[model samples]
Target: MSVLQPEVNITAGLQYQGSQEKALVGVLCTGTSCSFLYINSVLLFTLRSKPVFCETSRYILLYNLLFADTAHMVTNVLLFLLAALKIIIAYIPCCVLVLLSGFTDIISPLTLAVMSVERYVAVCHPLRHSAIFTTRSTGTAIALVWAYNFIYILVQVFMLLYVLTKIYIDLHLYDFCSKEAIFSAPIFTKFQQTYHVTVFFAASVTIMVSYIGVAIVAKSASTDRASARKALQTLLLHLIQLSLILTSTFFTTIIAAYATVGRLTLIRVYNVCFVCLNILPRCLSALIYGIKDQNIRPVFMKYLFCQGRSSVILNKK
Candidate 1:
């Protein structure tokens, strides 16, 4: 959602200079997104093709996380493309895009929190981990995450409708469509800020508590030291991932702070922040779990390099 606003502004400045820079930046952004998309797609296939991955509760949650991240990347790239192209969309379509983007944005951190708790349970309650995180319960948890976001989107929709009914505006947007542009009402802004703060706070607390619990269990003599250490490392990775995702939500505020520094400086900073905060966070899961996880790394590498048959043979052995 922050993509459109900064992109539109940046694109406008590029237009003043020439079309080449705009096109170059567009290609760069799109190509980067496509590369990550391909990597995520392959990782998804790897997760699905293996029976072991499909059957495990942790892997199931990982698939959910990757799917959400991929969807988020796609939505963001689409929004960026729209802004870069200077395409003006009608209000309703724009709303749908924004809502989808917001939904995807919220899901990742929540999923990370769930994954953290799963790791905690595995470490602290090893005997009950299997019983507690059964396939059915895992599915239910994912469903609840989606359902919660759906309800949040519905609330935004109602707020939008209420605002529309109260005021009259052109259906066609003059500026590039964005959540801020469409839902510019003070009430909507306040509500979004409050909702984001609450959700993030809850997720942060969940992840922190889970990490603490896992760390405590890791030190206990009764626990399997190796397993406890692994779980603790996983939880730390989750915290890092959560931190990246959380930083992305502050994109607008960061941009705002840099506004008075001149357009050129702003553009340079924006591009840096966009890649680091927005693009990188979406793809970090693949790098983190895809490469760092020993079980996933081999299969991921095989599929990544298009050696699927060979990977199957190895797995069979």
Candidate 2:
């Protein structure tokens, strides 16, 4: 990640606080399609109740990660596929795109916080662990995460599109995976930029700090402090993965904001490269979860690769 000079062509778009532009393409990018399917398939095999040993809480965390990653993938596929299909269809409204892309982008940090909460309960209140981590409770927690994230996205999206649409008027077609879609509305676009920066910063930092609080609680607990430490390590690793994967997306959105003002040359290359890079982590999320969770890796091997045939084939007399 070397520093590149800002394109001279970009105009008033530079007023955006940071990299908060057309980051939508990061979700709409095509490179991650196959990986999403593969990881999702593996998750089905490994996320069963039988293999989830109670000794370590990683199993629970891994299960949550599966949903998050699968969702992240599905949403990505939808966004990109729609972008491509729009070539054959008529005008697709920016508001619809705004809502879809906003929810799709928040999956990374939201799942991280879910894992942290699971670890917190498992470690902090061992007596009530089973009661709290029940199948019903787990489902409730998951539903809340998805709902909250969506609501958060929805509110801001309306704000972003509405404000930007009112102020500026940039009627142009911006192409990503699909043919250039017309954005003939600048005020709406600025609204989008403003909404993106606010949510991006707030969600990312809040989720991260939540995990840190979980880590602190885990450190104070008496039993399974070791597991707590392990969980924290995994959380840190996941956070790092998120930052790396999101690098391009964050930059691309910034580019989009500028490109709206018609600064479209050297910056476009940066946009393309970063947008493509988003898939690397998204597709690899399953592997990251497996690596982070000891229980998950063995289960993945047992079912996915069908290893450990020796125990079944030969009983040593």
Candidate 3:
């Protein structure tokens, strides 16, 4: 019956593939990642080395935000850039690494939101602020925010793998968070039919509400012109943060739409904005921090000029 032995080995021929250009791109991206690494490293180094803030709550908050940014930059930005460069490694599934990176990325924004709320309370609700957002409470709140974020993203990763394997059973592809493969997965399809879009919309709504809640709570408690003015500035800072995240969110959603809708017109625009979004925060934070943080301004200027002059000399060397 098996005389001629009709046999095919698909697995034998299927090879994991990428190109030299991809490796080069990954290297270039790795280099870019290193550049930020140096800058952020210096920033954090300075943060730790300096006695920049003494007995100041605002300084503490700035330092906290810096930590969030640093975490996001190190974890998310690095993984993403690596993934873009396609550096698959042993002992780690690319998907898991990528998911963890995404999870930490979410933590950055969530932490920022918490920081904004804390600041709003300190400025706007100065009376109950200590009781609510005391050091312990603030620490707890940050812990919970991070815990929830990781768990939530883990669920997404789980759903992407399991739900799709059960449903689509066809497109057994792994790029779940990708715009192209999102709805194509069977589990994602079921998720879409069930609560996917609803939950996404809900999250967006919550971020909006969080902003408004902070604004109202701050404004309602303002008793004088100066207090009201302080409330507004704090609110504006939060709004700027919100705007930064919102604009990036806009780019992500728009790119997703283009992927889903096949809108070629927007591909370039979305990609451009996405790159800007990735780099803008680091630069913008420096600018905002320089303005809001008096201690950092002079130090930053000295470093900027000193570093510039050194580079000029090095080029001659």
Backbone atom clashes (below 3 Å) for every candidate:
0, 12, 1
RMSD score of candidate 3 (Å): 9.9
* Candidate 3 lDDT tens digits, 166-207: 664443344323333343454544543344344334444544
Which one wins on TM-score? 1
TM-score of every candidate relative to the true structure: 0.88, 0.61, 0.61
Model 1, residue 251: what's the lDDT?
81
Q: How high is the lDDT of residue 254 in model 1?
A: 88
**Which residue runs does candidate 1 get wrong by more than 4 Å?**
1-18, 258-269, 309-317
- Where model 3 places Cα greater than 4 Å from the true spot, the runs are 1-40, 50-61, 75-92, 127-131, 164-231, 250-253, 256-271, 300-317
Q: Which stretches of candidate 2 lie over 4 Å from their true place?
A: 1-32, 49-64, 75-88, 93-98, 152-225, 245-251, 257-277, 306-317
- Candidate numbers sorted by TM-score from highest down: 1, 2, 3
What C-alpha lDDT does candidate 1 achieve relative to the native structure? 0.85
Please provide, for model 2 over 1-317, each residue's C-alpha lDDT reduced to its tens digit, 9 standing for 90 to 100. Answer: 13333453243456452234434443344545655567666755577636444323546555665666566556556655654445333333544553554565666556665665666566556688788777666667667867877777666656556756666634443454321233334554565466555645654575466567656777563657777677667657666765654563454445555665554343445436534554456555677755555656777666556454556567653
RMSD of model 1 against the true structure: 6.9
Least accurate 10 contiguous residues by lDDT in model 1 = 17-26
TM value for model 1: 0.88
State which candidate, 1 or 2, has the greater TM-score: 1
